[model samples]
Target: MVLAAPLAPAAPASRAPAAAPASVGGVSAAEWTIRWWRWTRSFPDGLEPYLDRDGRRCAMGQDDDGPVWFLAGTDGRFDARRRCRVPAGKHLLVPVINMYFHGPRLGENAMSCAQVKRRAAVNNDYLVSAVVLLDGKPLARPERLISRCFDPQAERDDAGPDDRRGVVRAAADGYWLLLPPLAPGPHRLSVGANYGNPDDPDYGRMLQNFEYELQVGDPAI
Candidate 1:
């Protein structure tokens, strides 16, 4: 059987009780949603407030490689997409996963905030992994750079609210990864999701697994 591989080592257990309802956590899923929403709204200028094609809130940045995108979907949907065009050299890749599905309508896997927090704190249960390949050989692992939170110290004050540097959370309630440089070519990138609590009503309802093909540096791609 395939096991979930986390980029970072397991974090300490969250203070919230395990297996409790979404509302039982120290911060309810709904409440966290509202908090995240308000925080995102106050984003400073040039923070590039916008939704990805899939409706997830995201910001844009740049490294020595090229453009970098960060997704922090308030709804926990965490869906986004873009055109295929690999940079000339190594680039950073950040993938976002909001385990606390927050929205007007609760999703099947919408469980107690504590459970979500636990998933973030102890990611062995819920994880998002990626595999990058060029010419049929693996190039990157999900562990290149992973985090459970977007902004732990609220570093937006120091880095500017719109800066991508402060967008990481300290807890495991969410997942983010900064991958190493990927070679330019016909690369195959796959992002897979396996999240949820078997004891919860929404178990197995939130799992996702998919792949994409990118013709790097190719104008016709």
Candidate 2:
């Protein structure tokens, strides 16, 4: 993987655009849903992802000030760095690493939290790679925070309001990359992935690469 030159992301637009559409590059999220019906209904929640008209991918849920931007590619196409603010302490890092496929389809493909680290990584053509630097140093990889990564429809009936707090959007990129509680300080997170393969005769699409600058200290409002 090529190391992207460090850069800062632009501030988010004042007007919040609606959620991502069904197409990334040229692949249609809608068509993907119909073709992969068994899994699409529940995973990536069958919803379209956000896209940039100029062929650029933006971070989902991330604010120029802080949090995260959803649905960006993981192939380093997104060379700009992003900013995210979070309260000091333990928090999960949920990232969407691929551009072509969505994941964590519970019940159907054995997508339970028990399998995310292994199954979710390879199944459904999903690929994810991430690097987290806290206070300029790498921290130990935390346990996979799977249960917290979820969307509606596949939502467990027994889940309460508390469990729903961590609910991710219904898109293909809605998988979690666990990060242990962060110390009160500034940090950097780099993520990369290949959605599938563009040259393959069958099943080909774009990929993703994203970076984030985090300020973890302030308390969650």
Candidate 3:
């Protein structure tokens, strides 16, 4: 009997990243992140896409009548690869490393929208690096893609009534990308980001890294 040599794993296929429009469906990339957050918080605990291990739950909280499809980053524990089927002619909204904050901490009476916005912005302050790739080509100036929004009326159906005396003030900040509709075919999307000062002794942690193997066409095909 002859013994065979061990085979090495192959990398994912690559192509140059396609050019994406500044805004799609009249929504800027910044606004899309807020919309993504609203969509994200709409789901109950186990059903939210951010906590999904595989791509099975990718379609969980999506609207059947929307112009954009939202992709999620994992819970930052490990790298996740998701196999998703995206409908043709739909723009893709991806969250690289985003943060949402709302509060009156433990003993506080109230928190303003500006206070919430500042708290949320802290998570992105020490960003070590963030990247978004199509195929394998990296997007330019990812640091410049930062967005911040304060929503005074933000509410989550799954989370019951607002805890802050009906104020419902909250904020979100992070790096977000809005990609134009891709051609109908198989394509690869990669998104990742890490925050915290590298000089700190405990700074090796990463926020999220996701790999999506997407089929842009009918699933029955």
Q: In terms of TM-score, which candidate is stronger, 1 or 3?
A: 3
Task: Report the candidate with higher TM-score, 2 versus 3.
Answer: 3
Give the per-residue lDDT of model 3 (tens digit) for 1-221.
Answer: 01111121211225243455677778667766767877777778767788776788877667556778998986667678888888887888887776777765335666765677776776566665565667666664242344343343463333432333334556677766667788999888876667764543432344667788889875511
* Clashing residue pairs, backbone N/CA/C < 3 A, model 3: none
Minimum summed lDDT over a 10-residue window in model 2 is located at 3-12
In model 3, the runs with Cα more than 4 Å from the true position are: 1-20, 104-108, 143-167, 198-205, 219-221
Model 1 alpha-carbon drift over 4 Å, by segment: 1-83, 94-135, 138-141, 144-155, 159-177, 202-205, 218-221
Q: What is the C-alpha RMSD of each candidate to the true structure, in Å?
A: 12.9, 13.9, 7.8
Q: Quantify all predictions' global Cα lDDT against the true fold.
A: 0.36, 0.36, 0.65
lDDT of 2 by residue, 1-221 (tens): 23222222221244233233334335344322222222223335323222232212222323334222222233334444555556654333334332222343534543434333233333233222333333444333212222223344542435642323323323233233434456778766654333343444332333345555666676432
Residue 137, candidate 1: how far off, in angstroms?
A: 3.8
- Give per-model TM-scores: 0.41, 0.40, 0.75
Candidate 2 scores a C-alpha RMSD against the true structure in Å of 13.9
> For model 1, what is the alpha-carbon lDDT of residue 188?
50
Best by lDDT: 3
Evaluation by lDDT, superior candidate among 2 and 3: 3
At residue 79, candidate 1 shows an lDDT of 35
Better of 1 and 3 by lDDT: 3
